[model samples]
Target: MKIAIFDISNYHYTYLYSQCKIFENDRVDFYVSKFLKKSMEKEGVLNNSNFNWIVLNDFDNKYKYYKKVIKTLNNKKYDYVFFNTLQENWLLNFYFFITVNKNIKINLTLHNINIFIKCSRKLKIKRLLRTIIRRIAFYRANSYNVYGENLKIYLEKYLMKKNINKPITGIPFSIYENIKCLNDMNNKIKIIIPGTFDLKRRNYYDIYNLLKNIKNFKFELILLGRVKKDFEEEILLEKFKKFKEVILFEEYVSEEVFDEYMRKADILLAPIIKQIEMDGVLEEYGITKETGVSFAAIRYSLPVILPKEIKVMKEIEKIALVYENFEDLIRIVTKLFDDKALIQKYTEKAKKISYTYTPLKQREKLFNELKLGR
Candidate 1:
């Protein structure tokens, strides 16, 4: 079958394209919308003929963008067109479906349904428009895919409200199947948090204080990803610099550097306090209803620390340590550091769970659902 995967977000196209290429026998054509051209250009060569992938960075107008793209691809006779919908842009996804020629099968990969719901609820005008768009999109989708089971449940509830019959499946994100585990275990514990350094999502100040208080353990905290040019970065840098063990890489690190930190760290901290639904000062911590960083930690065999109230986190409790406050976090980390047996147990459980979402397995399931041969 001739397949064309359209990655609207563009950030995930690299990983998505890699998965689609596993079926060498099937002719797969990949296209990324020009949303991240600057990022892609910085990374170097964009096209790989071996993978049958092309980066198209130009579109004439918003109204005719999908139509023209579909018309051009129709001439090549694509059997399936996979549209990767963004978490925050349901209306745009639905608009594309409505305007485009709908001869081909349409499948949507839902990254974050919670974000969509929360955003719609906050904005009255957007809520009404999005509701209509969602109803139409849900009705048209042949198959719906989600990253987590929680999202699958939400999608089903939404579909029921719209009186639409559709199949929503839990198709988790793909990770490298044969990832090499780090063998060199040392006495000093290294903690790394690799993600967007938004002050709202990550309580970096609280984390800094927690680490500072626990001086007995030889622990090093590494913060990766780019920090926005704001007062928050300046304040964080000033405060964290006093601690000799804390290392800050305040720029966008390469994939290799990010993976290096992941492998080196004894534990990955995803201490996202549930602050989105909270009141006043607490809301400053940017913990939203939908956060994807936990998936990354899970994929890397990192024991994630989260708040107890997060319902979606309950599934991975075996590999997670739930804590409500800084005291809870310090206690858990101290206990784990002192007990080698407990550390091994959690590490093994995390690795075992991570193996379940390997790229090869995910690809097989995705292809089978799409009715494409192995």
Candidate 2:
């Protein structure tokens, strides 16, 4: 099948494209626009033969550009068109309108729904039109794919409310097989907090304070990904600077280097603030024994720390350490550091549970559901 995959979010270069590599035999002709081109170049994965990366210089006016691009691309007669990100709601809606007018088959992959809902809130008339457009799009599209079970359920609920009948399949994100298992915990307790060091979302300052309060601990905190210089100007930096155990790698690291860090870490901390619209559900629902950071933790038999309220994460609560707040985080980390047996037990359990999320398995299920293999 000649498939055209469009990734609007561009954050998928580090995660999504790596798994897309496995679809090489599927004759997939992937196309990524928006932030993906820059991300692929930054990650040094832009030259892959299976995909074409396009950069959007005028992203502020993406709707006009998207319509033009889709019109041109659809002329090529693709068997399938996949939208890898949620912000493509407008593009997907437009695609359905145009494709329905022209009679073409299309597929959509929803990464998150909150982004579209937020956009809807801003543009009242556009929101109403888009809701009607979305219902039409759902009805016309050949297949609908969601990243997580929770998201799939949420989307289904929304669609049911709209009285739109369509099939929505939940497909977990796939992790590359190249990632090696580093089970050695002999090194110092290295913990990595990946993702943007945005104080609003990650609340890294709270973690810094938690670590600072627990001085003389042997654990090391590695802050990976982009950290704004303005963070130092903020008052939180004064407190963050006092934590000698915290090591900041402010610049974006290559996937190889990032994976190395994940392997080295004894624990992966996702101290995400509870946002009603955040993609944490994707992490909780899609994460299995074989995905990305969570999978790496499981592969290394390392324990991960997550918040207690995330409904899907509750399944792995026994293996995961849940923190109610920064104080709870400090308390848990301190206990884990002091107790070797508790750490060992959770580590083993995490690894055993993660096996269900492997790329091969996820892809197999996805292809089966899509009937693409047939």
Candidate 3:
């Protein structure tokens, strides 16, 4: 089958790259931003004859770029067209909804459930128009996908309200490429948090408190992602600096460095906030969205520490170390320090769970869910 995957924002190029590899037997065309192309090329995931990388400039006019995307899809006559994301791209989405052929399968991956479901209730014209376009594009799609089954139910309920009965599939987010999970038996158990240090998305103050309490234990904290610009948490940084074992990155972290740190760490600490307000919509992390750190845990086969409010899929439930509060997290961490065997045990269990999300296994699941024959 011929497949075409598009990610004009370049935010989801890793996902597109993974899809290309999953569908290696088929003729795949990946339409990505030039930055994504360069990133993939640097990562060496683009060297393939069966795959075509169509670079789209980030500075190009949105109208022209999306027009070319539609024209190329129609010209190539792809069997499947996948949109890695459709959030805030209502114009391009409306274009595809009205212009694309209905015979071709149109698939969309919902990165954020609340963004599509909970629109602003304000009487503003701009917000109302955007919501309408988004809903039309969403309803027009043949199928939809989410990162996990835990969130799929919420999406199904949303679609049901719209009276649109379409297939909603769950595909585990793909893991990092060519990396092995290593169980490091070190004196200081490295706890790594893998996303931007934004208080809005994650509870950094909780991390600060957790750090203060855990100083007596033999553990290190690694902040793996970049700090958000104009961050008001400079005082938090100062507080974190007081800890000798804490590692922080004030600037952008490259892919290589990020992967290296992930491989080196013993635990994936995700302090995701339960409730986050995005674009005037309230989103509950476990119910309305899945955390990227959970996939990071799957990728590196590291046991993840998450808040109890955030629920992981059944597949990784065993690998997740969920804590209800600061004391609970401290208890879990203290146990890991005292019983080194638990770390290795979770590592082994997580490794087995990681196998369930391998590219081959995920490809099979995707085919089965979409009824695409092997």
Candidate 4:
């Protein structure tokens, strides 16, 4: 089969890479931003003979870029087109409309299902039109893809409410097989936080407070995400500077470096701020939206520490340690540090779960759910 995968924002490179690997035998073309050409090349994501990497450099000239995109896709006549990221842009909605008009099968990987389903409170003209566009596309698309079964359930319930009959498929993100396991108990237990260092996404103050009172155990905090220069000085550098146990990065981290840190981590931390605003609607993590860190924990085969609010998939829930507040998080961390055996137990369970996410297994799951073979 011929497949075309699009990630206009270039934010879902990991997801795009996994799809490419899964369809290694088929003819596949990836449409990505030109800025990520070097990064894709460095990561060897374009080395397959059956794959074509098309760099889109003219996104600034929106009309010209999309015109070229539509032209290229029209000429190719692909069997499937998978959108890895969907932003709230009219141009993208127009593209979706055009793709549908062409009678080509389109699949959307919904990173935020709630944003698509929930109505905005401040329903201005732009917001209202965007909602209409999203609803039209949602009704027209062939299928939907989410990263977890729990998210699939949420999407299915929303579809039922609207009386829109559509198929929603959930598959775990594939494990990073290239990166080796590097957990070390001999040194300070490394708790790696895997997303952008932002107040909106994570609770930094709680983490700071947790680290401040750590007197009994030896632990190191790995701020794996890029810290904005402004936010860095405000929260990370100033609040976390005195502590010698934190590792900070002020710029974008390359894929290799990110995977390395995840591999070395003894435990994964996703201090999610339960309620957040997305596209003018309030949504909760693990319900309407999924956390990227949950997938990262499975990929790295490391035990994860999440809050009681964030509901994870079955495999991850088996190894996850839940915390209610700062006090709970501190106690969990201290316990993990003291009981090396507990850490090992979780890690082993995570490793066992990781096997279920192998590329072949995930590909089979996708095919069965979508009925692509027929």
Query: What lDDT score goes with residue 157 in model 3?
Result: 83
Candidates, ranked, TM-score: 3, 4, 1, 2
On the 0 to 100 scale, the lDDT of residue 95 in model 4 is: 68
Give one digit per residue, the lDDT tens place, for model 2 in 86-180.
Answer: 45356565553555334455666655454333234344675566655655555566767765555666767777887867666544454434345
Task: Give the Cα error of residue 179 in candidate 1, in Å.
Answer: 1.3
Q: Residue 189, candidate 3: how far off, in angstroms?
A: 1.1
Candidate 2, which segments miss by more than 4 Å at Cα? Answer: 34-79, 86-103, 117-140, 174-178, 181-184, 229-233, 276-301, 314-318
Q: Could you tally the backbone clashes for each prediction? A: 1, 2, 0, 0
Q: Write down the lDDT of every candidate, Cα atoms only.
A: 0.63, 0.60, 0.79, 0.77
lDDT (tens digit, per residue) of candidate 4 on 211-297: 878855777899998876664446565778678888888789888889778878988888888888876888778877778887887
Q: What TM-score does candidate 4 reach?
A: 0.92
Q: Can you tell me which runs of candidate 1 are displaced by over 4 Å?
A: 13-18, 21-25, 33-50, 58-67, 73-79, 86-95, 115-139, 275-290, 312-315, 367-374
TM-score of each predicted structure versus truth? 0.80, 0.75, 0.94, 0.92
Clashing pairs in model 1?
Answer: 200-286
Compared with the true structure, the alpha-carbon lDDT of candidate 4 equals 0.77
Model 3: per-residue Cα lDDT over 128-209, one tens digit each: 7777777776777788888877788888887788788788776666654547644366666888999888877888888888
Summing lDDT over every window of 10 consecutive residues in candidate 1, give the lowest-scoring window.
279-288
Q: Which stretches of candidate 3 lie over 4 Å from their true place?
A: 87-89, 160-163, 176-178
Each model's RMSD to truth, in Å? 4.6, 5.1, 1.9, 2.3
